[model samples]
Target chain A: MSEASTPTPQEDERIKETSALRQALIRPELGGIVGTIAVFTFFLLTAFNSGMFNAAGVLNWSTVSAQFMIIAVGACLLMIAGEFDLSVGSMIGFSGMSIALLSVTFSWPVWLAIIVTFAVCIAIGALNGFIVVRTGLPSFIVTLAFLFILRGFTIYLPQTLERKTIIGGVSDVAQGDWLAGLFGGKILGGLFTWMGNAGLIGVFERGTRAGDPVVDGIPMLIVWAIVLVIFGHVLLTKTKFGNWIFAAGGDAQAARYAGVPVNRVKILMFMFTAFCATVFATCQVMEFGSAGADRGLLKEFEAIIAVVIGGALLTGGYGSVLGAALGALIFGVVQQGLFFAGVESSLFRVFLGVILLFAVILNTYIRRLITGER
Target chain B: MTARSTHAPIIQMKDIQKHFGSVIALAGVSVDIFPGECHCLLGDNGAGKSTFIKTMSGVHKPTHGEIIFEGQPMNFEDPRDSIAAGIATVYQDLAMIPLMSVSRNFFMGNEPTKTVAGFPFYDKEYAARVTMEEMSRMGINLRGPDQAVGTLSGGERQTVAIARAVHFGAKVLILDEPTSALGVRQTSNVLATIDKVRKQDIAVVFITHNVRHAMAVGDRFTVLNRGKTLGTAQRGQITPEELQDLMAGGQELATLEGSLGGTV
Candidate 1:
């Protein structure tokens, strides 16, 4: 026993290295990592000469990715809990329209309008959850119903209130509002200005009246996306509630048999999905200073596609938040990479389809290899 | 009948009857499960065995019966209530999430949490350690607690379920046809696990149709035929052949076999 206990240092190191390799191979994010690297490398090879690696290029793609990631992360969680919310796209439009109408038309405080929008969105989210649970209906069908209902309202509400299909001048009301600065606008503006002055970053030709270089600051959307991803990763991997989400999604009957409150977990997932949609809507409305009924059209499918590429099973009970974030990054790179490479923007959909298919196949194959399933 | 124990049973059922609509699943069945003993319920298909166990496990309420648990009359509202009352049922399917890790499946709804900075998180390390220790105690050495339950062998999974129930402080472990789908080696492993659980002073209600299996580990046997108790006997009082005969409706089987032999 004493002789066996005193293993050689080389042997110990060998065992540790092999186990670490095995652990890496079995990780859920392995597919996402591969997909991200493959897509990034493809873009780097094809669009390098077109300024695709420049700061402006990075900002453009990152902004788009941040928007997708916000909802994708929520969709990832909800999917992990064994449900879907198709109305998330419409919820985004509806939330943005509500915030705009409340703050602009009613002359309410911007902060209060945001709060009211969140409350309304959350309530609708809860209703979706409640109906799905009580009626034992598939969330896909229920949320599909909400998808049309919300889209209809988003379009009809503005036309009814102001005889316009779009709500404009949202940024006008948001001006001078401290809360608006928190949710919208650029962060680290001073640092970017300094960088431009020091010739570290490229300055825009259109300078301000004060003659300061117009180097763009990091968008709050990107900040929120990063924060949400980290928060989601921690919640799913470190908390008891995370375990419940997995169990609920894996098998509701089995989870219930083990004493998990499956109903509550699913309901909260629905509410969280809605909350994420509202956050996306608020950021977009504040940034663009306008809201239209078609602002976030087809975003639900995009988010779901992002989640699928992230290695989450559509049937539920298995996923990774970091993987979803990486999936969003891949989307951003491809969509903008195509533009930089002079590929037709209409071909973006084709790229999205091919990437999604490849990701799903790779993910399934990897999972089978890990589980040793035939 | 061999001498019945004078000590009170952990769970006592009197005139238990269950009906699903017009179908009489179980009619007036009574049984007593004592701690530290392996009581085998032997029956054929449609013998009301599933309904009886479901009633005991709180999946179904008895239409006409009284359940006395730990010297107090009780009616469990659901499986959760019975589980809270220390009666754990490991069904044939085992009620385990296949995709989840062993430790996660072991804790499931009753996870051990550690609060840090006013936020509670799953104590994953603790769960893994306890799961490893408990599974090894049941003679099933797991590769790792993080291994998914679906990856485990059928016998190993059953042992894990039994160990999980014991870890959660189950006084009465009702196994519903646990060995029906297992091979010979797996069945023996499960029987060994039952013996281990019995030694730990937990009352084991082993439901099976296999007479040889019952004779191997059972301290007492109760035969159910067509929703009624055929009889109860101590292990020594009845041989395996006699138990098999009784399970097949002794007199009726004998007469039919004799007639067939005569015609041949």
Candidate 2:
């Protein structure tokens, strides 16, 4: 018999080294990386003279991206698990209004109100998952119905309680509350103040003492967004639960046959999506100190568009949290860059539509190359 | 071969009957799978082959019958219970996510995890090494354990599924129509893999409609027609042509062939 043709130890090492480069190229996040660089370059060329690359400009876009990333990361996870939570935008509105009405109107403690708001969001999320799994209906339709239901409630709640669609004075209730500081107020406030005093960075003048810079402390929204992205990336790539998510999304029946708890994984994913939406709402309510029924309008579609741009398949089972984070960054850059470039704000939507179309086509082409699909 | 004869059956289905409302999918079928043997369940389409195996694999509960596993009457509420009880069913579709890596697919549900930095993480390195080693034992030299399962040939995919079942402590491996979608070479490769599995002292219930393929690897054969068992035979006791005739409902095909003669 001929000698077996297995690779030698040295040959194996060489093969691994070469395959590493090939592997990196085929990663799902590669498209997002490319798109981020392209968008950053475009903005730098057109809007850099307007201080878009400076510390203050960077802070503005990063803060917006962070808020979007918070929801986009969750949306990315749900998409990877092969589902959608279209009610997320509505959940944000509903959750923000709930907190406002609870703390301001009912005179409840800010902490207690926050907890109740989360509980309500979690229940709504679980219901969405339960109905979808039990009836085997498309999550898109089920969550779409929730979108309207929650939006209607957001508008109706304040009208009933305060005789107006807007709920204000949340800041008054949040004042001196440590929980509010943790969720809403600026982080690194002292450090940024020191930087402003030392003339190292910009700070707010009118909102603070005289001679202060234009931008103050870092937004808590940015911190939460970054934390969520890292948490999501680890959960999707490292844990056994992450593997189950991929399996369930890829093929539910096959996942069940393989002994994966398909239904439970999906339900938990839905709950996580709602939880992220609540977190977004908390940041928004705390930042502005008020909430309207129109809060977070069209934000669900934005998160989904970001996920798709990150190279996640619309069908499911393939995506990256880091990619989704970058996708959110792209959205923030375009949204703010347009203002810096002196372009119409409405034109921002046109740019988003065009980017989403191109990103999806590029993502699909890359996925085909990686999966070797015809 | 004679030594295997003395071993108790790994799984025994006695008078298994499964029905779906007005349709009788399986009407009193029985099968016994012995260790260190490839027991081929031969039948045509709609002969209740899938229904019979689904009962054994715990995909469906037998409407009227008993499944004695390891000499104990077993009732599985889910496929998870069956897997834990050491029965692994590799369905015709293979029940595999194509985009996943070979190592991920190998330990899909039953993953090995190691705690690191106070958190549990999938032991990917160990999984990949084990998957590669196991597939090599079955004579499949994979390019890499991280390669997508979709990129593998039909035979390679089947081998991966079989190896996964074997690695997960499966005492009885039930393969459903594994070679039906494969080419001739891949079919032979799978048959050889079955032989390798049998030598490992695992009971394999290989279900297929192809008589010649069954004759190649099967040590014992069970014929089914009209959702009921026709008979069981030790490999050499039944000729391939006789097995084919029985699988096609005895003399019906022969009579049809006679009547259609001289058509040209």
Candidate 3:
């Protein structure tokens, strides 16, 4: 009794204290955190004098990275719940075209168009989840079907109605619109101007807009990324629902036996993935001032890759949102850093394939350590 | 064990019958489970043991007869309803996620939370402390509450499942082949856990095909053949060999031996 209640150092020899290094190695985010540091260091050493760290250049990559971060957040959570959203890339194009058709061509208010677009996309996501659960089919095949269907609609709709694939003049239609501003507007303009006046930031020397800061303000894209990451991180780590996500992904039958509503948790995750895709679409449309049927092609794979690099196992049930966010950051840095370092941009695909393989190997090692599997 | 019969049974399944279309799984099986005693259900693979327990745990509603739980005829539509009524069944697989931490698995669906600034969050410290304390009470020393459950041995995982059921206020605990997959030492550990739980006055329905395991901890033993009960016996009234013979259908075996022209 004494030995059972009190785990003294002399008692229960099997209870060896895990070494700190071993503990760190067991964390799911270890690979992502390490990769983030390694990528940043590599870029710093190779592209230091190439203007990659300057405000303008920093924004350039940050904007690209933020786009990845938004979608990666959704994919990370869905993957943790033991599902995938192959339709996410197509969902983006479909939603963007919906917004453009409603506001620019159909003469609907931009705010109404944005709200309706989100609603439609979210419903489609829920349908994807519903079919997977009710039919007991793998989400891969189900969403794969939606991927082609939505993309086909995206191209077919514009060609049939507007006689063109790309719809422009959306920015003009969205001017002074409340919902559009949330996606397309910038913030902290006054602070950037003050910094420019104080010589803290570079100013245009002899352009038409001389004496203004080269980088005016932080775009809403970056802000949205930060907000979504914090939200996803908190939702995953600090809530009862978060625990359910892990359990559902780890073992769905076991989770159901434990009284968790596994079906509902999975469906909600699919909807969230669609919602993230829509956010990306809205931001892209507002930034480009146009929507093309070909927009967001293959972005689903990029989001999944970022999530995998963030240390999430492809098998699900284990991951970290902060890790996925850092993974997106690495992608943004490396993609733009190659251009700054005078490397062929096509080699970026090669880097992705190599990094994914490395991350998977590291994740498998971690899984074996956790499960003691051979 | 004699002292436990003085009070009424916590659960009484009277003439429960379950059928799957034309095939009858359980036909009029009755059992009484009392508090503070281990009731062992011994059966072969096709003896309808799984069907009987599923009916008791509300997985399948009995087609005939009724379940009188706590002296009232009750109906359970689903497993969740049975859980709400203080009946918890830990299956052979243990219903545990191998990758989740012990504390997280401990409170998988029913989590305790504390409100912080109008937002509720999972109370980790409370959960961890309770998990460690409850696990120690079962004589299984965990490294820590944060250790993944997959790292534990099979017996330890079974104990964790039992400990979780007890912590959540289970009045009747049903274990489905708790030691079927463990080594000899691990099997003894799970039997000891059953003993500990029975001491706490919780009715433990231990299901097993092993006669030696059942005799070690069972206060009352009920053997099932096909879909019918072969009567029940107290600890000292039945020998292990008789129990084993009853499980394997001794008459049928003897008839087969005779038909094959035994060497004797």
Candidate 4:
């Protein structure tokens, strides 16, 4: 009688209580962490005595990694929102040319030119999003169209106005320009000098500026990369909107049923992608002292590859900013490490393809484990 | 019935009709839903059950008739308007992202936030705590709030959706085929969840074609056939077989039986 009258409990035997170790294994950042360590160890072993760890060599790869980081953060967020922006590379070229045309050719204040360039580029980004949302077209197609249009305009606009695909004299016009300094100038020079005097780092042995540290203050590009990574990570993991992004990418119909503004989230992510591209373009033009029509060729693919290696699903709905940043670091290290180890630089592409395949396989296995699907 | 009949209905559907061009989906169906009562809407496939719920939940505007909600004549422009008016519909799909954690799915669009140094954070601790409490209240003791919704049983997922609606102040809950895809044990758990929801004084419109499942927790049963409600009957006044016959069309079944001959 007591057995028949026993009350039913809510807890079921089917739901497995996960352990802390198992939970950590399921994190999206696991592959990135392992890959970063593996890459660093490989480089350190092969390129240790080739001055690859020197101050200048470290900066070389870090700057390149920062470029990849800027665009990867944007791509990572957009992928999580269930969309793609293929126009990012062309946008870089277009934004640089626009900044040059406004500041140098038109003789506008460098600050105004930079601000106007940002506004115009961001508007174009918004237009990309608008077309995608209003027409219900895939963002891949819409942004692919913009990629050609922007690249064409980038090449055509300079040739039509100045009879050249590359614009020069931008650095001369930008000298003493306060806005230009933010992009091009380095910081912490005094600290570097102090380090040089204290013999903490290599110094100029027999140059006009002797006893100067080989590496000076950090570049604004790296600063911007760090800032954007922190911002993107915080926004993607700690805010209510982050949940909406996951929902929108995971199942858009479900998100809408729950009252999420999916279109708005997707559009904003596209705009953010454009914004990141423009930041990269501005820093490139400032550092190089000119803008070329083919400046950012294939950078969009590089950013997407970095994100993929960082463990984002190509189908969208799952990823991490920290993982993407680590993926960028691996790219930077391997690209520069190849040259340091006396290997052909072109082999970098081969490495990217191989690592990308491995990461995707790892991510797929993790996905299956999480979902319990065959 | 004595106490419930005295209380005015929370939602009154007066002669509601819906049409898809030449096809009439719901034809002049009227049902009054009282608070704390389980109103089971029983109907066979293509019998206007979906259309009727869609019209009631603001997914479609009726071609004719008015919806009186809380003594106010209401015309919901869309699902959002109905949701804002305290009507939450958990459709068959449950509108849940399988990859997300149970807490995340519980508060998908309506996440609770707490200001931290002037910045609003997603208050995950509070959300997790509340999700655990609410799930247990609905008779589902989840392993943890972080368990992915995909890993949960169908009945557990339904409980999560229902608990979410209740926590969000839903006055009337419309569940479309909540137990259709569940196993027998899971179906019983869901029916028990319905009972728990009703005890909270929230009106539940349990839509299903299964007579046995409907009879488990349903206080009143309304059967529809060919775009019209045959009738509404109170508990103890109707049996499971009667409800099944009404859903399958009593006269139509009799004629079908006669056509089959009396041997078997």
DockQ of each: 0.40, 0.48, 0.58, 0.63
Q: Spell out the clash pairs found in candidate 4.
A: none
**C-alpha RMSD values across all candidates:** 4.3, 3.0, 2.6, 2.3
lDDT for each residue of candidate 1 in B52-81, tens digit (9 for 90 to 100):
999999999999999999999998888899
Ranking by lDDT: 3, 4, 2, 1
Local accuracy of candidate 2 as per-residue lDDT tens digits, A318-351: 8899999999999998899899999999999898
What does candidate 3's lDDT look like per residue over A24-86, in tens digits? 898888888999899889989999999999999999999999999999999999999999999
Candidates arranged by DockQ, highest first: 4, 3, 2, 1
Query: Quick one: best lDDT, which candidate?
Result: 3
Segments of candidate 4 deviating more than 4 angstroms: A1-20, B250-264
Encode model 4's per-residue lDDT on A1-374: one tens digit a residue: 87755454534556567788878878888888999999889988999999989888898899999999999999999998888899999999999999988887888988898999999998998899889988988989999999999999999999999899888888998999999998888999999899889988889999797888999889999999999999999888899999988888888888888888998888889889999999999999999989999989999999998898888887788889999999999999899999999999889889988998898999988777666567
How does model 2 fare in lDDT?
A: 0.88
**Candidate 3 lDDT, B1-264, residue by residue in tens:** 678899999999999888999988888899999998899999989999999999999999899988999999999999999999999999888568888999999999998898999999988899999998898778766778988988888888999999999999999999999999999989998998899899999999999999989999999999998898888899999998778768877787556657877521
TM-scores, all models, native as reference: 0.93, 0.95, 0.96, 0.95
Candidate 4 has an lDDT of 0.89
After aligning candidate 1 to the native by TM-score, how far in Å is the CA of A80 from where it should be?
A: 1.1
- How many clashes would you count in candidate 1? 0
Q: Which candidate's DockQ is highest?
A: 4
lDDT for model 1: 0.87
Compute the lDDT of residue B127 as modeled in candidate 3.
92
lDDT of 4 by residue, B12-82 (tens): 99999898999999889999999999999999999999999989999999999999999999999989899
Q: After superposition, how far is residue B140 of candidate 3 from its true place, in Å?
A: 2.2
